[model samples]
Target: MEEVEIEPLGADEARDILAVAQDRRNGTRWSVALALGLRQCEALGLRWKYVDLKRGTIRVFWQIKHQRYRHGCKDPHACGERLHRYPCPKDCPKARRTSGRKHVCIKEGQKFCAPDCTKHAPSCPERVGGWTFVKPKGKSKRTVMIPPPLIPLLKQHQEAQQAERQAAGEAWQDYGLVWCHTDGRPIDAGQDWDEWKELLRLADVDKDARVHDARHTAATLLIEQGVDISVVQGILGHSQLTTTKRYTHITATLSNEAAARMGRALWG
Candidate 1:
């Protein structure tokens, strides 16, 4: 496998981002991601039942995944124009970069799709495309200890959510998610990403930082604090120590500390 780039926020940068995120509705969600190194799906799928405020632990059992729609109609070709697949239009704006399965209808070659061509499962009358909670694969389902400082934030978030629920009244559709929309609906992953970008912008941090980088930040921070590599692996729910090591990056402080330790040992 190709090496993955690991760019993590510094301590000050993380503080800035958290301080900005505090005013957002799902602020605690970001906090949990940073503190626990949770995958985006795990954090979004987290439910109140899995969170033990008294025990200060969170069981990461579920992940919110967007499953692709499949054709449920008996006669896909007979489906409406919206359901029929089409080749790239002559004036297609995305033609320059389109390729593979996303570009042209595989069955139609380079020609325009037949009027009865069966395609675009997403538009089928009985389509089934949406987000649903599913079990996390492998060791990702392990439990994580919540940091002491984050406990109060979680409580405050819960109280705020209760207020939102009351305001929503009959509109609320509780799925027991620790973080959700004001109406208790599951938050779309796209929306979650947008919020992360907005938080970075507000915090004046790296504008190009990806949301998953928060997990990298958590791993790096743990290693910097002298946490054992195996312990960090367990906390991150990684199946292998090598995977956990990949998420950690060496910082100037770590280098300086290593040099200082070497100098002290050698001189003494």
Candidate 2:
């Protein structure tokens, strides 16, 4: 397997990020990621119905995904005059084999058509793909306990959402997502990513850190606290201990602590 570089935020850095996020809209969303290690899809798909504030738990059953479009029309070739793909010119130097004998022009070449031609799946009357909520993989579908510090943040988020709902009035779509647009529609993944980048900038944290790094940070934090590896695996909902280990970054502090414990056990 290819080696992955795991860069997790320090405890102080995590605190700074959370503190900055607290004042922004949907700020609790970032906190959930850093504290609970929820995937982006899981966080986006989280619904208010699945969050039991009274019980201090969240049921992670679903994830939001953008499915690719498929040709739903009866005749893909005849769907539209411009939609039909044509073979490359016989002597065209740019033609490359797409299958056993067929060849097509380069994607940017204007002289010859490429596969799918000018087909616009989104414009298809019977297009069959878009953003939708689906069940998470068996292992990823697990309940997460709300951290004590996060409970009040969640409540505050609820109050803010309620205010937004009232302001939106009849314009709200009411998708029931915990984190959504002001109109209650699900937030697009791209928009969510942009927001995360802005949060990092505001927090003065690593600007290059990806949103997924929050999961790594959570795993590292849990391990640093001396939480058992198996327990961290369960909290992360990883199917294997190896996966959890991959997410956990062992820092110098953790290494030194381990050495001290070993020395005490052997010398004492």
Model 2 lDDT tens row, 202-262: 8898648887888888888988888888888888888878877764446776888888999
lDDT of 1 by residue, 1-268 (tens): 2128878889889989999988888898999888888988889989999999999999998998888877688866566554344667766666655444455433434543475565667778797766688997777779889999999999999999999999999999989899999999988889999999999999999658888989888898888998999999888888877887764446777888988999999996
lDDT of 1: 0.83
Model 2 scores worst on lDDT over the 10 consecutive residues at: 109-118
Write down the TM-score for model 1.
0.78
Residue 104 miss distance in model 2 (angstroms): 30
RMSD of each: 7.3, 8.6
